[model samples]
Target: MFRQATRLLVRPISRTGSRRFSTDLPVAETADESFVEAWKKVIPNIEPPKTPLSFMQPRPATPSSIPSKLTVNFVLPYASELSKKEVDMIIIPATTGQMGVLPGHVATIAELKPGVISVHEGNEVTKYFISSGFAFIHANSIADVIAIEAVPLDQIDSSSVQKGLAEFTQKVSSASTDLEKAEAQIGMDVHSALNSALTG
Candidate 1:
């Protein structure tokens, strides 16, 4: 039993040859260096690409930069007094159709019809009913409306418009000659438009 114990104690331990560790082994110290220095060593300095001269120039005036108010000149043959009135927008019943004009709009000339013209400034709107005219829109934010006949919308009487429309309609139906019928038809159209403007 003693001999067997001695043999077991003297036997060499078999190793799989993976790794071995000991407290007595020497360890090399790390060098003293900062992260910024390491980054600078890894990356080289490079200048950015040049930009074109046009890109550096001042930008041209845009639509939003233009003045929002429009100078209006509403006129009649007898009265050309409503001049240089600054308004935000103008809604006109043009011969082509109803059109809304704003600041910085392209220059145009439109013939007016018998309907309402709305002048807007901020939240408040002033309306006028015109018989016939022409409107000119300029590039300089100026608009001129030359009306043959114009009155405030509230000033128009509904009873008078109804009576006029009925009379013109009767004339249109009873006329004998073509010229008479044409004239009556025009009168009826104007009266009907006036009635609509008053009621609307």
Candidate 2:
């Protein structure tokens, strides 16, 4: 069966004498023109259509071309309005990860961790330590940071943070139940973040 299959695969194809593969055929007379000649005789020259004057005019500027400022509304609970102004950029410490938002950033809602939020404008940068909250970045260059508690970098006292860290650490170590340990750990984390923010 293998020999028979090989013989059939290697078989030479027979060609009929009527079939022609070369371009050496005799041309028809001028009166009996071929299809190509008939097409060339009728079509003649081909030219592209001229563009209109309106199409040549310059296009208008796009929305992205004109630089826009990001409007930031950094608010806190207890009627504390930290900032309600426009900034160039905002670096948020989101729970998933850190995110930098600009004017044309895509819309998103991120849960902020107990970390610092940096607001940049021109050559100056302002930073604030936030407890926790949500940040909403809109498509129209508007960012709203609603935090539970927010304090300016300069306003936070290093000594107070160190003391709180020590107390929280003690509480975490002495925690008896799981719930108590979790609460104490959360407090310690916040204090640790506060200490870092102050020193960093």
For model 1, the stretches where C-alpha displacement exceeds 4 angstroms are 1-65
Candidate 1 lDDT trough over 10 residues, lowest sum: 23-32
Task: Tell how far residue 117 is off in model 1, in angstroms.
Answer: 0.6
lDDT of 1 by residue, 77-165 (tens): 99874689999999999999999999887879999998999999999989988889899987678889999988888888889989889
lDDT of each: 0.74, 0.73
TM-score: model 1 vs. ground truth = 0.66
Models 1 onward score TM values of 0.66, 0.65
Could you tell me which 10 consecutive residues in candidate 2 have the lowest summed lDDT?
22-31
C-alpha positional error of residue 64 in candidate 2 after TM-score superposition, expressed in Å: 6.1
**Which candidate's TM-score is highest?**
1
